[model samples]
Target chain A: MTKVKDIGEQGLLERLQRFCPPDVIGDDAAVLVTDPEQSLVVTTDMLVDGVHFSNATTSPEDAGWRAAAANLSDLAAMGATPLGITVALGLPGDLSVNWVESLYQGMTECLQQYHTPIVGGDVVRSPITSLSITAFGQVHPNRIIRRGAAQVGDAIVVTGVHGASHAGLKLLLDPQIGKHLTTTEQAALIKAHQRPQPRLDVLPHLWKILDNSKFKIQNSKLRINNSPSPQSPVPSPQSLTPVAGMDSSDGLADAVLQICRASGVGAVLESSQIPLPTAFDHWLTSEQALNYALYGGEDFELVLCLPPEAAKTLVQQLGQDAAIIGSITSDTKVLLHHQNQKIPDQVLNLSQGFQHFSP
Target chain B: MTKVKDIGEQGLLERLQRFCPPDVIGDDAAVLVTDPEQSLVVTTDMLVDGVHFSNATTSPEDAGWRAAAANLSDLAAMGATPLGITVALGLPGDLSVNWVESLYQGMTECLQQYHTPIVGGDVVRSPITSLSITAFGQVHPNRIIRRGAAQVGDAIVVTGVHGASHAGLKLLLDPQIGKHLTTTEQAALIKAHQRPQPRLDVLPHLWKILDNSKFKIQNSKLRINNSPSPQSPVPSPQSLTPVAGMDSSDGLADAVLQICRASGVGAVLESSQIPLPTAFDHWLTSEQALNYALYGGEDFELVLCLPPEAAKTLVQQLGQDAAIIGSITSDTKVLLHHQNQKIPDQVLNLSQGFQHFSP
Candidate 1:
């Protein structure tokens, strides 16, 4: 069988070099810059093949899309304008050339959708395939957002729907579950888990807020490429920011707890206010759906802490895509307030999410 | 047994938060900036646990040092000024907290030595430990070097000692054979393998060459901040770049081959001029030593092709820290010329280095 050893390092790089960002592949380092007023925003993420995605359930392309999304979401959380990305890959010797090419095609799709390009990278062999992506972006220094600045009375609003990725994972892990839902529902759930849409579309709004000037994406030259990703939802332009900002990948409750701990404040979740996927009722009860929305991970939706007026305005602008799920308080605990007729209120002593080290 | 799940994501972050750069840990992304005259230069590298370093031979800190060195060396190859780094880590669930702490300590030592602090990153669970570091630096846009730009008659120069890491790896892999070596030889070899210095000290000289004007690190006010890294040589204040620049991670000959292939030229190495490690005489003949010097990997040294005048000036300024290794030629094949009485000259058919995917 042909192996990476046969192709050699340079051979493989040559195969993939055309996909690299222009003016990047052949240099010791990629070069980039922005206006002096903008600070460079950077973050990185790594995804292990087995731990983050199984080959049986996820195509190489989906893995690449998700890897780029993870880093892009971090930049989106800061209202940063994405500039470029560098991908470092660890791959198995037996990995086929086509698989890698497809993977990069997926990355290209996401980067084009977001308007950022791949800069430069290193590829080496490992026992299994894994990916590490570093995303660089730009933001006005004073306009940057952080998770530790949420005010006690800020209203917590989230972008987009939740629990779809969790449902998708459940289906991917068990094909038998596919019998319980329609083909459309199954496809939607699978897509949600495989693809994540970063909140970068909100940047134009963020600019408007930070600059205290009326701004509209339609009025600006910045094009909103509305081409929906196979793994993500269709685009909607509603966006806003508050005292603090966080992109939820570790589930809703855990994110609340994280913000509370970071800001030394408490949080209260209105369980009834949390949005549930419409088809979740087909296989899951309303209560179970809320639980999945609460504790399931990989949402990529943003949870923002804003004043009551800002939160209300953002929700109005976002229409039904978002809801005010919670509020901050001076108390030092995160609690859930369930007003639903089907569920009882509970003072959540624990807000757990995806555990990286969980067996 | 405590799992990473036991500590929870936030708990793990808390353990690492103290080591983060200022205003970096709590944010969605870290912010950095360089003056308008300079462009941001970025590079990334990944170290798989078993592939790059094994726990059997490398301590957590050594692995950390090596990982950071890989990326830092890329920036150094571009003559970029260090600014910050983001390290994404993938770790096994069974890893100890102490191991992680110690690893960060090693990264801290390397970054402090290079004056690049940790900015931001994500830590996730994987089957084994793997680290991905993103190094961000600043460089004058007009002066940046590329491997494809080497002139046919340019003189090639290399910095620091070569093949020591290879000798060190040999010792590390076989302790039984190591018993034959002197203690001084053993220590030096092991040190070379375990600790890699990124060569940031040579930056001032690089600045001088690139700008065509004298520049001193002391005048920048960026702060040297070096407490001395165990793996790095003492401050020598010497470095340079030319029309083409590449770091020697894949042995001298392989790097030369890469430059030749990129620049559409050839190279000729003067075997008599190449430097050998001090311990070569203890275990092998001069021929074997020279082979290692030519074909061993992880030297973390830079090989550059400069105009004759620039090469002469840089060599004079750099003194013994660098040497004129060879010259680029119009011919396409890389050749080695040896006039030494100990060995006959040989045409290198395969100037192979450590192959990442070799079976």
Candidate 2:
């Protein structure tokens, strides 16, 4: 066996160096040239073999997509436009070139959809396959939305229906679940589990909706310029900011609690108001549906709080895609309202989430 | 063993979510807020156990420093100001938390020197230890330099002395080499081999010298800037640019050839003009010195081409540290000039630099 020292550091870097294009390969960092005025957004996600994906069930392509999507969804959740990404891949000795190419193909396809480019990365030999992706995006500086900004009395909105991914995962892990579903249905669910689509389409219109809300929130804050089509005045940092926001990667209920904790507030979620996929109902009971809606992880949807005055315009702007699932409250607790009865707050404590070491 | 599926995807994400502070951890990526007007620069480096470091010789702290330095040097080479970093670590099942903390401490100490924060990262179990760091810096977009900008008639400039790292490695791997040196000298060489300091201080002054050309050359189009200043103007898109420019990670000779290939040009490097550490002469023969300087990797110094007009100012700015090591020629070959004789060109057909796949 060739020991690592045999190749040396220079030799290792040179071999991996050829895998990257020179334009962005060797610099201190790869440059993603965006319009100077835009705010650069960045996010990173890591995947470990056997922890995030199983070699028994997942192809290398699926593993790559899951790894990339996990990071890309973070960009989508912030409503930031995709820019560029760097991949850090760890491969075992038995890994083949074909596996790496397939993985790259999956990553490249996703990147192409969002117009993000793979600028540079590092490849190293490991005892097991591990992958980490750091993705970059650009958005207008003032328009860059954050998870901590959601407000009290604002409607909580989420993009896309939830729970199918969790259901698909269950089916993938237990073939018995697959026995009940039609072949096409099982395939659809499995695909959803493997390749979750990041919601990039909603980003461009996010700031516009927020701006319209600002006008409703405080009429005095709106200063319309007379030159040509006047633009809305830039809002002060303290005014009409998002009071509470989070991505529902850990299920809507878990994310809601996180937002509440960060903002020093509570929330009242209407159980009936939560969106569930039609396929989800076919697979699970109403209680299971509610459980999944509240706690199913990997939804990759945003759960946001907007002030009441801004809620109407925001909903109108988002159309049917965005839902009003709850409202932020002064009480420092997360409450689930089912019908007319209020259930005791039950917080889900995740011992580990998507971590490699915990299990 | 606790299977990863038991925790599930959302569960795993939620488990590790607490490691990231809410203020910086955005839904998509960790949002590191630096100076808003400055352009965000990004770089990544990955290290695997048995590949980049060995259990026999490297400590956890040394591994951490080397990993951070690898990425940090990329930033230093770009002339960008370091800001923050995210780390993704993969560990074996039996790995200890104490080991992880020590690694973090080493990384923290290095990053703290430049005031770079650990914004976020993910950790997972692997069969062997692996680490990946994605570092972010800020620079002016127009000032961001690239490798393909070297022009003809431009003087070639390198930062600091080369061969120290290669010699240091040789000494570390062969304990017999240490017999000739004092304890402190041996320790210094070992430390250099384990934890090389990236030249962050020289970046700010790089463009000043390159633009002025204190080094001598015949052609003027290829201007390589590896200094860490964010204010340098970006080369024009249409600029014929550097005949060739690269970081001396894989020996100066190999890097020069890379530049030659990139710019469709050739180079002639003078041996006596090249700088070398005094200690290196005793350990290595003149021929070995030449070979190390030519093909040895991991020096992390910048090799750049500049026009003749910029050579004087470049040397004046860099002072004694800068050397006019080589010049670009239209002949499309890399030649050595020694004792007033032209040595025959040597071809490095196989990528002779460091690779992650050897083991």
Go through the candidates in order and give each one's DockQ.
Answer: 0.14, 0.15
Stretches of candidate 2 exceeding 4 Å from the true structure: A1-37, A178-185, A213-240, A312-321, A340-359, B1-41, B138-144, B211-244, B319-321, B340-359
Question: Tens-digit lDDT track for model 2 on A1-359?
Answer: 33334454334444434322332222112223244456455667668878778877778787777777767777766556776677777765566555666777777767777766665566666667788888877655454455545455667887767776787788888979667678887887777777877766666555556566444355223212211112223444434334335567768777777777755667887777788866766677667877766767787776766666555566666676568887878788777666644544343333332121110
Each candidate's clash count: 0, 71
Q: Return the lDDT, model 2, position B99.
A: 64
Instruction: For each candidate, give the TM-score of chain B.
Output: 0.76, 0.75
Q: Could you give candidate 1's per-residue lDDT for residues A57-81 as a string of tens digits?
A: 8898898888888778878877677
lDDT of 1 at A265: 83
lDDT by residue for model 2 (B1-359), tens:
33224444234334433322333221111222233445566777778878788767777877777777767777765556776677776666466555666677777767777766665565555667788888877655444444544555556777657776776778767889757666766776667667777767666665554333333132222233332224334334323222234567757766677667755667777777788766655666677766666666677777766665565555667676577777777777666667544554443332543231111
What's the TM for model 2? 0.78
How good is chain A of candidate 1, measured by TM-score?
0.78
| Correct interface contacts retained, every candidate | 0.31, 0.25
lDDT against the true structure, each candidate:
0.68, 0.62
Compute the lDDT for candidate 2: 0.62
